[model samples]
Target: MSPEEAPARRRGRPTGSRAGAPETREAILAAARSEFAARGYAKASIRGIARTAGVDPALVHHHFGTKEKLFGAALEFTFAPALVVPEILEGGPEGVGERLARRFLSTWEVPEVRERLIAVMRSALTEDAAAAMLREFVSRELLLRIAAQLDVPEPHLRAELAASHMVGMAVLRYVLQVEPLASADPEELVGLVAPALQRYLTER
Candidate 1:
């Protein structure tokens, strides 16, 4: 076929281009963050993210392997609420505790994310780079966003309490794999845990 008649080459993923070119990868990651922030993990689409990045969807797929992997990458970089809780605060203050608890627990169950979370937690405890990342995210993205959503007076304090409680549950259930806690039905755990979080966030 003539050059004019040949198929148009995709941008970012050039013909014979190497995988993970710095500019392309950074572009994709930035677009991924924007997409995740706007749509949350479950609703964010690879096609949409690729478009946002000015790349092909196949490039994104080849780069990350799966949505779970991409989400994990996003979290490892910044630990934003979009990937962490998806849209936990979207439904408003009603049942937010259940939303937060359910989302947090379920997100930790994803294998790709679980691995990164382990790394993050360990590094955080040891005061590494991940520690700074987590601290910034929790203080800015997680806590303040959550605090802003609630009707409570000490919203920041309430948000902090809820985050601590949730993280403690994760340590026992996921990191340590404590029996009963680890083995318990998720709904049952959510039932047990959501009320306290709700009280922390909403109770005046």
Candidate 2:
């Protein structure tokens, strides 16, 4: 080969070089998030995520192990609720409504979280197992924790109501993208919604 050709020779595995592994993983995660958000858990495919990421389908399996694990990671990264929710509830029951509303709205406004939530909700509507998983997470992690902290007699009922209110608003604003509601100021929403939430937590 010519000297110029020799100097230009590729140095390592075409795509699997050690230096490229982290980049590949990030690409796969970004593509997987988009796929899961658009397709829902039941319809999203590892092959499709791999195709979008421009990697071998086997690479997706190698990275994430299984579709369920991928979905969990994608959702966790997208929503990041485990980090936010507890912080929101940290101020105790008196501040719960405002804190919850602010945090929920802020979290949902994130593009990835909004998309992931819509995907999860869609999956919950159509797939029983998906719905159960969603319910279990919300119930065990969110509602129950908040309920236990409250002084109300029907803490569970109040928690459910609060959850319903937040979920309903999310569906309308994020998923449906309904005009004014979709574009409404976050503070305005907090003002409007927090009272109802506060009442649920405090009232008989």
Candidate 3:
């Protein structure tokens, strides 16, 4: 090899030297969440997220492939509720209402879950992509799980009704913080709300 020939420039892009792929991916996700929050999913761009993350646009594409998938990853927190929902539904159908209410309210009362949900809800209000992702996840995962367990006419409708009431209660208790509803004991709230949820799940 002649000295002027030069050692071939190593191919492709240089690897990130400090963080491994997983850490860089996480950084991208964190930046994506912030970008989506600030700009909403429709306006949030791969280049913008990459800029916020201090990584190249190609890295974002390399990790997530597209804006849609990046938005989905940004909203990954929404999936955690699915994990707890089945546990809440696990008992005999008899007092499922009370169990569901107790568990649902209890779970969201945690600071982390409450804050995360508030952020998702805020994003969902303004972003069609955010709304679609959340709506699809809940309908398919949470509501349908309960509906499938019921042996009732129009079980899907029944499950939806039950979910609606719980959702309203959650909004009031956690989001709106409405008066006594927000401060009411979980047991007391269960007493007031569970019977209606029970009727929805079992009746007709």
lDDT of 3 by residue, 1-204 (tens): 566333322322333442356889988987887777667767879999988888778888888899988777766654576456567666767888888788778878788667656667777888787889888877887777877778789988888888788878878888899988889988898898899988887776
Cα TM-score of candidate 1: 0.62
Tens digits of per-residue lDDT for model 2, 96-175:
78888988898888776677678777877887766777677777767777777778888889878988999899998888
Candidate 1 local Cα displacement, residue 58, angstroms? 24
Q: Cα deviation of 86 in candidate 1 (Å)?
A: 8.7
Say which candidate scores most in TM-score.
2
Stretches of candidate 2 above 4 Å error?
1-14, 18-23
Better of 1 and 3 by lDDT: 3
Off by over 4 Å in 3: 1-15, 18-20, 34-39, 43-48, 51-55
Clashes of each: 0, 0, 0
Model 2 worst lDDT window (10 residues): 11-20
Query: In angstroms, how far off is 77's CA in candidate 1?
Result: 4.6
lDDT of each: 0.73, 0.77, 0.76
